[model samples]
Target: MSVYTQLTDDQFAAFCQSFGVSFARAIPITQGIKNSNWFIQTTDDTDGAPSYVFTLFEERPPADIEKMAVILNQLDGKLPVAAPLAVIESEAARTDNDKRYVIHYEDKAITLVPCLAGAHPEQTTQAMCHEIGAALALLHETLQALQPSEQYGVPLYPWSDVRDRESQFMPSDEAKLMRDIWHAYTQLPLATLPKGLCHLDMFADNTLWNLSLNNSQKGEARLTGLLDFTEVSAEHYVMDIAITINDFCTTWGDAEQGESVNFDRSKMAAFLQGYESKRPLGADEKRALPVMLAKAAVIFWLLRLNVIHYNRTEGRTGDNIMVKNPDLMKRLSAYHWSHVEKAQNTVFVLLNTHSNTDQNNQIVGVFSSITQAEQAREQLIRDQLTPDQLSNHSHFLIKEYTLDQLL
Candidate 1:
């Protein structure tokens, strides 16, 4: 059910009066998705007066709001975040509201956050990527300062887990595949891998840029404000980068011929430089990155598919996690199909080496262009082969499939 909140003129006046502040008007500043958002404006507009963003988590439970607030407060200065400010105090705090200074609006917590100003970016340049990298590095550096966030649900829930979702599709094969993939995911060395703050959903929209300085490059945009810490889940920080790459800088974000998602190696290099400027990644961190990317790809695929497969016309009550992004889904699908080869193709001057176990293996080669990977995978998979077969065999398979057959 869609939550509706109507503050008549009288009610609005009384509410503002309770806070000892008067407002000129309330504008719908929120780009609401699943929840409602509004901006409260005061008539007294000086050069730098404060503004507030009213976020009504209509479907979010009160406990969740409380927990999210606690997490945000802990992450305020530490992470690249804009946390909410509550006026009422919880009974534990021995202050006014006796319930964490939060207002109950339609049974959900209504939070008024200090609105920060920043511009939504269409593209990012190398310098901007560097800033983001730096921000994330800084976040990772401060991870030890805060405790792990409470895990309400399982970290990665495959579609197969839900019987209803399985029944919705043909033969339940998709669900079976998802279940199998989920098992593989859990079996991976997740526990042994590195751990830190992961912004699980730091899409470009979550980041806000200010035009403090403008150069020709998109990645070099000025650092303004990083907003929305609601999806700050715990994991390897690189998981955040993988999600970020898929969302903003990868082919997935590129929709048109000219409107490309710019991935400047120099800019990405700068980002890495900035990240390493703070807490540098260890050998272990680098080795685990591939599996982390794989995890991100799986999550990204399901996130996109859930919206299309499950919630076509109905109001999305389960989550606004995945809205319909054809480009994102397409790229994710492409990545899923090609990641193994793409990983091989991305090898640089670094030599391939293994310490006796599959998990200890590492390959290094020069990164290939997207065109190169596509051409290579086509030739490699002309004749189907399993992972073991592809690994053990020393022969190319394209000569087996005829052009007409392939066609």
Candidate 2:
């Protein structure tokens, strides 16, 4: 949505001609970070004719862009995705071959998607959260129809390149917190978790809503368009849920205001209930929710940092380029951890007997009996813990605790 690559009026007009449209104007959309987007207004002004969203993909290859287009087209009627419009196949355009949805422009991939109706909701309601949750679940289920591909939508998160540079860019405390949350995520039964294509970024701005201004239906908002599938990829269903909840359920506050992160319990309950109506979460997924929520916040915090780093080094600074506040995400990450620590189910504490610090202690599992805790500790050592950390049984200790004792 940001204007990284500025285009001239003549250039835009010619670009629109490929799609057999008389370009009236190309208004740069300054909202997103990954791509150059424009509101394409055609001169046709004909009845039933529609406007389009012209996108210049900053990173994705033409092939990947085409794949995204396929996904959008597949979900066109099923969901309110901004599906890419195929280019008119003139002899000149036919040279690209099979790349109808995406075209090459200065070695960059570009696409034309229908400008969907409805505006991005400024304040999300419980009903909006519920609809989005159901839509997301439906999206995951619908994408399962596609043949699973090893080389599908862009790679999964905590990308090694971004992760490796985190310590270099972020403060030691923030970096350590991010690392700790990620480590906790590694302890989960990820392989056994339900997997499907996920819109890894489902923030409020990414969704369009037909918000009722007047009292037509108790001022309810209905989700219309789901935008920006750049981060859509194969992911765990629970992780997707976590990502969506981190945005839809939480009330984001500006860091300058000194406001703490607030997650709406009622909204979260409504959202989850709506999702379960479509695809019920597994027992393991349910248990992993708290950690996954924290993990989701960590991912976005890292993502914002990466964006800021690239913008600084690459000289992508301007009003047109939107750089999200990484600090807000950082605060959200810390808040989710609080939720994780406060859970009543967090009964079994795994202590590193070799480590002297309180921070080394972790809540490993929730079990009624010491035998169950012992079994979990053994499994954790075998699977998650390093050999050096678990040289012998004396290195680890499991302590049962009540909620009050935890405080």
The deviation in Å at residue 226 for candidate 1 is 1.9
Per-candidate TM-scores read: 0.67, 0.81
**Per-model root-mean-square deviation over C-alphas:** 10.7, 11.8
lDDT of each: 0.52, 0.78
Model 1 is weakest, by summed lDDT over 10 consecutive residues, at 396-405
Error of 1 at 252 (Å): 5.7
lDDT of 2 by residue, 1-407 (tens): 78899889898888888877789878888887889988888887565344998999988778888778878877889999888877888676477547587779888898887788788876677777778889999998888887673356677655656877876776788888888888889999999998877888899999988866762268567788999988778888899898898889888766675655778755775677678779887779877887898898888887888888888889887789898777777888898776566554446666656555666655445664332355455555656667786547666677756655535
Instruction: Identify the candidate with maximal lDDT.
Output: 2
What does candidate 1's lDDT look like per residue over 84-131, in tens digits? Answer: 655533346555433353567567766666666776676666456667
TM-score of 2: 0.81
Candidate 2: which stretches are off by over 4 Å? 46-50, 91-99, 215-217, 344-407
Residue 107 deviation, candidate 2, in Å?
A: 1.5
